[model samples]
Target chain A: MAVVKEEEFEFHTGQNRPAGVPDAIQFIDVHKTFGSNQVLRGLSMGLPEGKVSMILGPSGTGKSVCIKHIVGLMYPDSGDVVVAGHSIPSLSDDDLFELRKKFGVLFQDGALFGSLNLYDNVAFPLRQHTEKGEDEIAEIVNRRLSEVGLGNANEKMPNELSGGMRKRAGFARSLVLDPEIVLFDEPDSGLDPVRTALLCELIKEVHAENGGTYVVITHDIMSARRVAEYIAVLWRGRIVEAGPSQELFESENEFVRQFLAGESSGPLGME
Target chain B: MNELFALPREWLAATGEIGRFMGTVMGDVWGGRVLHFFGESLRQAGILIVSSTLVIWALMFILGLICGTEGAYFLEANGAPAYAGVFAAWCDLREIIPYAFGYMMAAKVGTGIVAELGAMRISDEIDALEVMGIDSMTFLCATRLLAAWIVLPFLYLAGMGGAFLASYIAVVQQVGFVSSGGYLLIFWEFQNPPDFLFSLIKAMVMATAIVLVGCYYGYNAGGGPVGVGTATAKSMVLNLVLVHLIGMLGTQVFWGNNPNAPIGG
Candidate 1:
C-alpha cells in the first residue's frame, strides 16, 4: 500500500469556487486510513453544482468511501470535506445531522428497510424529519415513485423487486426529500446493459427536472458517457484526473485514457 | 500466549463498547424519538415473543420435570418423600427457572437479534438510516433494547408459571411421590414474593445484556455474509457467558445473605 502524505498535494480550500462553475462539494486534501489500508490519501476534488457528476474508479478504489465522507457516515483523518459551504469535519453531531438533511444517498443495494414496503421506504425521511400529514406524504411519495417508474410497485417488498426495480425504488426514495445533493453508489452494479441504459436515462431525466447536484460513483464507462456532465476518475486513493465530462472524455492523461478505454494494457496493471 | 492476551483485551474492549451502547440507548429512551419508535419497538417485541417464548416455555417445563423427578427419587429413598414438593418448589422457583430462561434467551433471542441486525448492517440499511438523518443507534439498537426490556419480564413470569405447573404435575400426579393437596400446601408454604421478584430481576438483567451484546456485534459487523454469521456466533458466546455471570451476581445480591423463604425462616 502506497502512502501519500497531505503535503504532497496542494489543497483547494473552496474559498474561491472554480471559474463559471460553483462547486457543490469539495474535498481538500482529505486523508483516511483503515488500519494498514490507506483508502483515501490526500484526495482532493470538487463536484459542480446543479449538474450530474460521476466518480469513476476501479473496484478497490475509495469511491464508496468518498460518498460516506460526504454524508458524514465517516470522517476524514486529516483535511476537510466541504458540502454546500459547510465544513463536514467540523460540524457538531446535531449540525451534521442538519447538514445531512440536504443530502439523499442511494446505496448499491437500495438499502430499503426490509420490514417496510416500497411506499413506506420512500416516505421514511419525510416521516422522520417532517410532520406532514399522510395525505400529503402519500402525494409526494406517489409522484416520486412515478418519476422513477415505480408507480405500480408501491406495495412490493424490496426483496420482491428485480435488481433494476430495486435501484429505481432507491432512486425514488432518494428524491422524496427534494434534497439539494443526491448521491448514488454504484447504481448500475448488477443490471444488464439494457437496464443500465434505461436507468442512466432515468437519472438524466431526474437531474434535468430536479436541477440539483447529483453525484454518481461507479466504474461503468458506458453509464458515465451517457449521464455525466462532470467526471472524476479516482485511482489508488487519489484523483487521477477530473474536469468537465467532455474534457475528461478527451483527457490526454495516460491513466485516464486507459481507464476510460477499458484497455488491459495501461498504467493500471491487472493486479 | 498472544492469543490468550489478545482474548482478554478484546473482551474488555467489547465490554466497554457495550457499556457505551447501553448509555446511548438510555439517552434515547428519554429523547423525543422514544415515543416515535415505541410502536415499532412493540412490534419488535411481538416478533420476539413469537420467535422465542414457546421455546423458553418448553425448555423450562422440561427442566422443571427433571428437577421434580430427581428430587422425588432422592427424597423418597432418604425416607422423606413429602419433602419432594418443597424441594421442587424451592429449586425451580429460586434458581433453575431464571438460569433456564437466561440460557434459552441467549440461544434464541440473542442469536436472532445478531442475525437480523447483521443482515441490516451488511446491506447498508443502517447507513441509509443515518444518511436520512435518523439516529440508527436510537432507531435500531434502542428500539430493540426497549422492546426486550419490556417483554422479557412478562415472558419470564409466564415461563415461571409453566415451570411450577410442570413441577406440580411431575411430582404429585406423575411420580405419585406425594398427594396433590400435600404438594400444593408445601409448595405455597415455601414460596415467597421476594424470590419471584429476584428471579424476574435476573431475567431482565440477562435479557438486557443479551440485547446489548447482540446489537454491538451486529451493528459493527463487516466483511459480508460470513462476517454476519461470525457476529451471530460471537454474540451467542458472549451472551452465554454474561448470562451465567449475571445470574450468579443477581443470586448473590438478592438472596445470598437472606434466604427469604416463606416457612423456613
Candidate 2:
C-alpha cells in the first residue's frame, strides 16, 4: 500500500454535514488500490436514503470506483462498505447477489445487452426476478421506457440509438425493477449541455415520482445544481465537504467552492 | 537471472488461473445452478447448430477427401490397392475428422466466444448482469459450456458421416483402386463399434477443452478491444496445441495394444 502524503490532503476537511435523513449507503475508511495506484484513501461518506445524492469529483478522482464499491463490483482494500445494512465485502456470493436486487445501476454508456432490443433490455430484470407473464412484463417495461422518453424506440438496438438515447434507455432499464436504490455513473457524460440538463430533469422527475436513494456520480456542476438534493465533493479519494446541495454550494472550503463553482482559480489545479 | 524465469512463471500462473476458472464454471453446471438460465443454454445450443454445424461438416468432408486420396495412392503403389478402405476408414474416423473438427472449432467458436464476451465485459454488460442480481458466471460461462455439451455430440456424429461419405467417394469413385463393395468390406473389417465410440470420445473431449478454454479467456478478458484480440489469439494457439495433444493421447489409449487389424485373423 502506498502511503498518502499528508500535505496533499490539506483541504480534505471531511466535513460531512448531516442530510437530516438516514443513510442508505456508508463507506467507512474505504481504501482501494489498483497495483500501486491507490484510488480511495481512508475515505468515509454517507448517502442518505430516498434522495438524489451527487458524488461530485474531478476526472480520475475515484467517483466511479465509489459506485463500484457500493454495488460490490469492487471491494475496498481495508475498510467496509455498507449498503442498506449489509456489509458489501463480507457477504457470500449468493447473499451479495440477493442484496444487489435492491440496486439499479446505470453505467456510463447504457450497458444494454447488445443482443436484446430496447424493450427486452428493460424487461430483463422483471423476467429474471418475477413470475410475471409477458403481458405484465411488457406493461412495466413500456411504462419505464415511457418515463425515460424511449417509449417509441422499443424495437431499436442499442447501436441504433444516439448517446443520449442510450443513456435514457439505460435509465429506463434501471428503473424497471422498482429497486430501493439507484446508482448512476456519470449520467451526464458524453451529452451536449441541453441533453445533460434534460437528463438532469428526467432524473429529478423520476425521483419525485418513484422516490428511491438515487446516487449520481458526476463532475458536471450543472448536473449537481439541477439534480443533487445532497452533495459530496470528492478529491484524491477523500471528501472535502458534503451536505445538503445548497450547503455544499455555499461551503467555505477552497476545494469545495472551486469544484462546485467550476472556477479556474482554487486549491485544485492540474497536477 | 530472475527475468530468465519470468515468462514461464507468468504462463504457469495463467494456466492455474484458467484451471480455477474452468473448475468454477464446471461446478456451476454439475450443481444444476445453470438450470436457472436453461433457456440461455438452449439459445446458445441453437446458435451453435445454426451458425457452426455446416461449416464443421464441410471442413471434415474436405479433410476426408484428402485422407482418402493420399491413402489410396499409397496403397496402390504398395500393390494392395484392394485394401485402400483400411487407410480411408482409419484416417477419417481415427484422426483426420477429429483434428479438422478441433481446428475449425478453435478458429470459429473459441475466438467468437472471446470476442463476444470480451466486448460484453468492456461495455459493462457483464457488470450490468451482476448488478441485476444474476450470477453472471452461471448465466454466461456455464450456460455456454452446457450449450456446447448439449449440441456438439450430435453435430460431431453428423460431421463424421459426411467425412465417411467423402472418403468413400475419394477411394472408390475417384481413385478407382477398389470397387464400392470391396472398399465397404475392408472398411467394416478395420473398425468396430468401440472404435467409433473412441473416436467420438476423442472429438468430444477436444470440443470440451476448446469450450472451457474459450470461456476462461472470454469471461476474464480485460483492457479493451485490443485485449480481446490478444485473448482470442492466445485461445487459438492453446486450443491447437490441446487438439493435437488430445489426439495423440486418445489414439495411444484407445488403440495402442490392438490396432484392430483383421490381417492375422
Candidate number of the best TM-score = 2
Best by lDDT: 2
Candidate 2 local lDDT, A50-95, one digit each (tens)? 9999999999999999999999999898999999999999999999
Report the lDDT tens digits of candidate 1 across residue range A1-271: 4555655333222122242588999999888999998989878888999989999988998999999999999999998999999998899988988888889898998998898999999998888888899999999999999998889999999999998888899999998889999999999999999999999999999888888999999999999999998888887778877888888778777778888999998777767
CA lDDT for candidate 1: 0.86
Off by over 4 Å in 2: B259-265
Q: For model 1, what is the alpha-carbon lDDT of residue B79?
A: 98
| Candidate 2, residue B131: lDDT | 99
Could you give candidate 1's per-residue lDDT for residues B1-265 as a string of tens digits? 9988998999798778778877787778766566677877998889888888899999999999987888888899999888888789867987788889888888888888888889999999999988887778888888888888788888889888889988888888889978888888888887689878988888898888888888888888988999999999888888888988987788678766664442322
Report how closely model 2 matches the true complex, as a DockQ value: 0.92
Q: Chain B TM-score of all predictions, in order?
A: 0.92, 0.96
Give the best candidate by DockQ.
2
Tell me the TM-score of each prediction against the true structure.
Answer: 0.93, 0.98
